[model samples]
Target: METPERGLLARLDGFFFVLAGLAAVYLAYLTLREGITPGWPMLLVVVFWVLVSYLVLPRVHRILSRVYVPDYFIGRTRTADGLLGDPVNLALMGSPTQVHHALRAAGWTRADDLSLASGWRIVTSTLTRRSYPQAPVSPLFLFRRRQDFAYQQEVDGSPSQRHHVRFWACPDGWFLPGGLRVDWLAAGTYDRSVGLSLFTLQITHKIGADVDIERDHVVATVTAADGTATVRVLPDFFTGYHSRNGGGDLIETDGHLPIIDLSRVDVAGAPEAALPVVRIGRPVQTVVGSLMTSVRGIVYAALSSLALIGSRDADEVTAATSVLLALVLGLGALGDLVLAAATFAGHNWSRLLLCASSVLGVASVVAERLVGNLGGPLHEGLLPLATSVLVLLALSSDSAREYALGRRRRRPAPADQPS
Candidate 1:
């Protein structure tokens, strides 16, 4: 994955995601607490929480991660949508079992998976001031999915705060700079408190401002537990610096990626076979993903438009307006469908057309919002607008642009013969 130079609008859009996320989370919490009464009030809060946590926040992450996170590993961990979540300050070279042994020996407990049972357990534990050493940590995505495993150590027996690290198994055939091979990449952060983020205002773990402290803490504990454990800090691996995470929590780090090698330690019976390597062009992926976003936006817009037909203005609405709206929505969907087919077939113009359409759609949404003409429920307009922006940004990426233009060099289909 590659990150192109970000324009001003893109930067603002990226920040907007964080802002929107914080707002949503706060609203959800307020709804849950204030709406907790008998009957519908309680029901509404539950629904709001679910919608914000599961549906809305995930989408926000998807959109913002692309802008804030580096596409390539620059000694940092990336969120699901490509935003910088935490710095990848630690690396381990060992089999999965060996890693387990080392961490367990270091007195860290494996965190429970984030499921309904575990989630509820953590909430109750936090509220009741109970110890939950193996409490689940909220997952941050890497390699297109959540961390393969996580380990955490409770601080002062408090369920609300802990030292945690998430580890992801390295992709097959992938190597770090200088050919350094690490089995697992990790991001370690200390939860100073359970609180809302300063920027996003979302109810999330407020990590200690200095992440380097936590990074060294992990290395120290692990190394002390096992005599065989050793660490080699890649000097200035990420460069000594201070930064902020996606939640806008302050963080300082020495850019060095600590490489811990425990390969010699025997744990599992035998090492598993290396996974098969799969390769696909990043640009092609952008095109396909953008097409999907376009389709989603088109559908939302169409549904919103149809919903508006029931308004009192229906008496004054002419057939032309209805027909025009239907035609536009149909065309938008049809365009994305065609672009998806053509882009997959290696047609370059289709990619360009897709990008053009995305830009137009986003512009239209902005225009409507600014003029106070956006109709239907607020979410109806906001959701599609957000999706359009995401699609536009994806299509504008360097990878997408290069792929589109690079493919254009193929000689035109034998025009005379085809005709």
Candidate 2:
């Protein structure tokens, strides 16, 4: 069961991530539609699309994720790029040490964090037909962040094929149905081969046709080592079904979420700590800056389109007029950067300042229409106006309000010594 607020936020998150991905695809289509016509112009467009999709969009999603993605357990997790990913098919009830001991005893090695060095190592290992028992797994998101950690086992002496599962420590006070309680939730999947994504054409892992096999394998291994632990199956927790993952690979599952109780494993250590609630303002400015950076290409195009603004030929355009136009564009860009900085520094006044800018944008567009000077289908203020609205919405979200007002509880002070 989900609260109304959580439900609404989840829907918004889904919409934003999906739409942003589609926007990237649309940009790619616009750039490559001419079948890669010869010239530096075409090359630049392709390069720009790659940067926006692969880099800029991910940053935007990460920044906004705190606002719209719920901070509690959900049945499924998201991919690093915000696409819906593997289902949460397993839960563990135990201290972190117990879980760690059981998994290691069962022969599963904790995967390395995905970084440039590890990524390159895996690529080279695969090319050389060597084994990489602890290769890193691609990131998957739960609780609006990437998995806390992952564990994997190489298969058939191949670096390209493996079984992996990502774990996320459950939020404080979260509970499951049927009196079930867990300290960690996980989504396990098996990689059968490497292939290109049908949607984005990016090279990625292709999972085996059945994910249930790996899910059961995980349960069996843990139980074999920790026989005292209990096992409970939530029948049809996600009805057994078939679907495609973010990379468009076929997936099938039995839908039973197996809850493994390792509390009796006698492993003495601290349980996994719940994550603290992060204030929204910390990342909002970065999000704004990334959005602006993504659209800088559009700004450049608009500048180029003004080549003949004041005169027919390029040389006839007056120096004063050119300087004035350039100044206007530069100032606009500078304003965004300044606002981002101010917001990050916790100045609530900066948000109001941006809201005022949005109002001005609307007024200017209306005036242009009234004066019958709306020469183009899309007005100059359109992008800025849209951006202003989005910024206002982000700043006004409940999380942002809490952050702006500094409403969080402070830690208790240490007891004073006798005077």
Candidate 3:
């Protein structure tokens, strides 16, 4: 049976496929009308579209999930079971020890132990907390009061079975103050050490928290054996919020810690610990990028209009220019809309849209060039220049700058610190 999450993901995948098809059809129409050979350009566009659709979108979705989807694992586990259950569940949650034991029991000498991390490792906590207010305010609210809350009673005299789990590769192998908890296990149990390890690697290395961008500081706490650890994050850590009630706090940290080589220890798991990925700050970047890209398209349309103003057959030039303008503006608008949808859509579709747009842009440029209507030297030169300038501007924007700088600084320091 398909779980709700699986259904939602399926719908999202279908939606993007439809969107890509529409964008491609529109681009094809313009290409054919302009009497251009849609060979290399079309192929490149389709390839790019597929890459964005399959690869970039999935990665972006993962990043977003890590940011916004708190309790991501809980949801993901459900979906994985719904899609390819037996194998995926085993691969995702199965312990190396369990696999090794099973293989050994089956008389296999090659069975090896896989050391994996599991359980919740708080990547970076934002001021935002999931709330279940009694009243229904916005449909946009994810954890509505109508769902995600429940009550249960123990009927048997037997005590509830408690599951042991451990969080590996935590920044300092320490828990936040009053953050750890334990509870009875109603679901099946497997060592989550691997999941914890993968989660830590993703947050600390592969996927970055948006705090590296929006906030001017990076705060990370590492716990030592003594349970006394210091954080070496930026000076501006936790500066975004003051109190959950009101106001804000200015948090800071320097990227240096006293804790080292904190090993894993067994502990009980909590209900909240099973929650899937929670993403924060990713949507802001997507929305901002989409808006800026759309604005550039509008500017491009204006330029095209001005260029066609004084021709012998002004009507024809104007019509053709309008068609081109519509293509650019329409695609830009669609891209922005898709990006906006992504904010609530629980998936990343912007990459696919971007790829499609890029493909179409290239095709349009080539088509315009082939038909004598690309204007003289100025028009020919301007298009490429405009595209290059836009790309550069997009790269240099505030969000992109922060992301780049954050990534650079996240790397290990040189052998010697400069005096």
Candidate 4:
């Protein structure tokens, strides 16, 4: 019997393979339309297939999760007792003076310490505690325009924390996880951590009361019987996204404080669990997907190359067709490559590239349509030209050289170097 976490993980894996199969079928459609050549090399097809499986699959996962999943899962919150729940809890229940003293002792400088009005305390506590509500669970239909999943964490007969994760499933079997927002309440001075974990994800605030505004990730402050030590827990996504965007963060008291862990639980004997594996038996599926993508790319490249050779004489139709084909192929290929880079680099640049490519493609298409070239190839080809330009920009050795040299110039001069 698989644990809930393990079961969910397996389900996700199966979902990915199913997605890959769909991609293969789509690719087959494209290949069949163009017809496969007898001379098509098997090795080339195999290599392309591997790239689609390894590279394209991951990208698709990220895009789907972001575009489809709900905002609730993307936003997470976890709270626990700080300083081992001894001094902090004591101070919280103690007089205002005592709490102030405790805060001072914990190296917290209260620049604006004021007692919250009546009923404020309840609201604040409610925000920090993790509690779940009793409600009938429903299938999170990915096919629907709006899908929602709600889970609550409860303690002492009161709701302590609540989570509402939502997502939208596209026709491509991609779940765009969005609307992941969390709310909690911690009674007294409790240790707490909350943030999102995704591919090239970012945290913009501190997790503790004595927040350090300069930091980008969560760092826990530990207070023991002897002394206090600040610790940091790295963030990672748990589910609803690809591994690049899949990581989890630990947020609980370091000592013997009660902690609640709330996440997706895959119930045993679920019908989805019994679904047969689809990708393993269909090797030809991936092959077809790979070939289709490759043929599309080659055709686009060939057309673009032709345009470059005879760009002057080519009628607007030919130019547009070549450009449009190239743009589609280039954007698809580059999108995959950029996502792969983002997975490894975990930087902001990957997102920028992806966004730029998407925007450029849309803009070109809109421009062509609005400019009265609806049937003309030029309108269609503009995106391909832009894609080619972007690809060249990305692959250019000169750009890389300039970037390296620029970084070197920005580095501080060594003390040994004549100051």
Per-candidate TM equals 0.55, 0.61, 0.24, 0.20
True lDDT of residue 105, candidate 3: 34
Any runs in candidate 1 off by more than 4 Å, and if so which? 1-61, 67-69, 80-82, 268-419
Ranking by lDDT: 1, 2, 4, 3
Model 3 C-alpha lDDT per residue in residues 1-419, reported as the tens digit of each score: 98797577446444443333333343334433333334444444443444344333333343344355445222112111011010000111123333223223323233111212111211111112221111111001111111111111111211121111111212223332234211111111211111111211121111112212211111111132223222222232122321110001122222221112212322224122232243233334445445556555566556555554533356886767766766665565565555535422323344334434544554555566676566433323433433422332233223333443344345577779752
lDDT of 2 by residue, 233-259 (tens): 888887677877767788888888889
Which residue runs does candidate 3 get wrong by more than 4 Å?
A: 1-285, 288-296, 308-419
TM-score of 1: 0.55
C-alpha displacement of 282 in model 2, angstroms? Answer: 6.0
Candidate closest to the true structure, highest TM-score:
2
lDDT of 3 at 394: 33
Instruction: Return model 4's CA RMSD, one decimal.
Output: 23.4
Clashing residue pairs, candidate 1?
A: 22-200, 65-82, 65-83, 69-83, 69-84, 237-255, 237-256, 238-255, 238-256, 239-255
Against the reference, the lDDT scores of all candidates come to: 0.68, 0.66, 0.30, 0.31
Name the TM-score of candidate 3. 0.24
Highest-lDDT candidate? 1
Alpha carbon deviation, residue 239, candidate 4 (Å) = 41
Any runs in candidate 2 off by more than 4 Å, and if so which?
1-26, 33-35, 40-74, 80-82, 114-132, 143-145, 156-158, 268-337, 343-419
